[model samples]
Target chain A: MTDFLYNYLHVYLFVALFMLFCGIVGVVYRRTLIGMLVSLELIMNGAGLNLVALNRFVSPENAYGTAFTLIIMGIAAAEAAVALGIIILIFRKYRHIEGGDLREMRD
Target chain B: MNFAEIIFLFIIAVTMGGAATAVLAGSVVYAIMGLVVTMFGVAALYVYLNSPFVALMQILIYVGAVTVLIAFAVMLVGPLYRRPKEWTTAGKFGAALGVALVSLLLFVRFVTETFPRAGAPSFEMTTKDIGRLFFDDLVLPFELISLLIVVAILGAIMLALFARGNK
Candidate 1:
């Protein structure tokens, strides 16, 4: 069991995949903009996990994958900031942040 | 199982449980708290994967900054008292479940078939290595990320100011 825990690469891969799955479910089922944003962060996290896992198991010598993961973090931070700003602006305009109520352009 | 394996299993449980709570919780603040839990679990996993620097950054940027920002946004938006509308009906839920299961099976099959079972060789990844790489080989992207953060900060401030001016 310990060997299985330490030696297997597929376990990490599956964990990352599961994170992606949960993120997708959240994205589809969530009704609020903030919920969707949270789900999106989960997706980004899944991607980061995949990168680090592959980097560790496949090529530990090169720092490329780690660097990429760092960059992803940077981008995720910026994205969250921008997304929150947009959410605030939306609340200011619409008076609510429900995903359904922003249907002014639907017509 | 050894201590390390037990700890790893615990971390996995924490991660999955936190993610479930983040998705299934009714309150947005509770969801954000779940996200913080999930972030900490991921950071612990990073340590197991031998990337302590990334782990630290994950905790710092994610739990430290992003979650706080999200919490502040939830507060700024005021109380969301109305029950969130169920966007996915039973039929949609079934469809989504089917798609997720199929994709997961396909990915598992692809991975098992494509990759060899040889274990990863252990190697040390010091903070020094990460720093040197950032400054030497990956300098341009590093600089670009700084620029991106500056732009994002300015844009967020501008957006908030614009909204205030509209009042």
Candidate 2:
């Protein structure tokens, strides 16, 4: 795919920026904890895209970008697993997973 | 456009569309579905980036595992009802849009100004190269990542047990 956008860094960067945008807006607007978690995944993926894009475009000779991307995926998987577990626990205690209801901290 | 270019464009559309659905969907179940699509789209992009190994891992780890985990949480957490309203007001939403635009401008400028143009590479990094790297120069970070994963898994299990009220 020797398309202009595919070969260049501009499209990738814009896509990453859009991912970050969606993530932030989702975090702010999402009512459910699980929705926020989904948004968080987008944010993490955005970071990974940035890494790989720069790796391909800026320093084509190195694998650090790809390595960091692998690490990011690992961390993201860990984060999603942990966050989802916490969401389930909160739902168990409160009977719902909406963020608006979890205002006051309690045992 | 050529076939490959068309496919690339399609992938980008899938990614953007999926992300939009994920963020704007009314229910978490639908949101997870959108996320899975987005994950696949991103993995495809990785192929275009000349890192097929990362692309495979992206599909394996993201589309295979993470979305499944999210789907499980979605199923377990509560009844999936349509969200009636958002906690955000016009003011807040406007503020978020403002932040997004401002940050976009800044970051775009930074990258365009700083990063130099790159040409075609002589060698494409492969899975074997990555594996060799894991054992050679990147061993330390590799081991650290494994340790982090172990901790995360243990923590998740503990949390899930707590949720079961069977400590």
Give the per-residue lDDT digits (tens) of candidate 2, residues A1-107. 33366887878888988898888888878877888889899989989998998888777787888989998999888888878778878877878777867986465
lDDT of every predicted structure (CA atoms): 0.85, 0.83
- The DockQ-derived docking category for candidate 1 is medium
How accurate locally is residue B160 in candidate 2, as Cα lDDT from 0 to 100?
Answer: 76
Off by over 4 Å in 1: A1-4, A104-107, B83-88
lDDT tens per residue, model 1, A52-82: 8888888888878888999999999999999
Tens digits of per-residue lDDT for model 1, B1-167: 77888888999999988888887787888889889999999999889888999999999999999999999999898776665543546676677677777887898898788767777687688889999999999999999999999999999999989888979
Which candidate number would show the highest TM-score if scored against the true structure? 1
Q: Model 2 lDDT vs. the true structure?
A: 0.83
Question: Candidate 2: where is the Cα deviation over 4 Å?
Answer: A1-3, A104-106, B82-88, B117-119
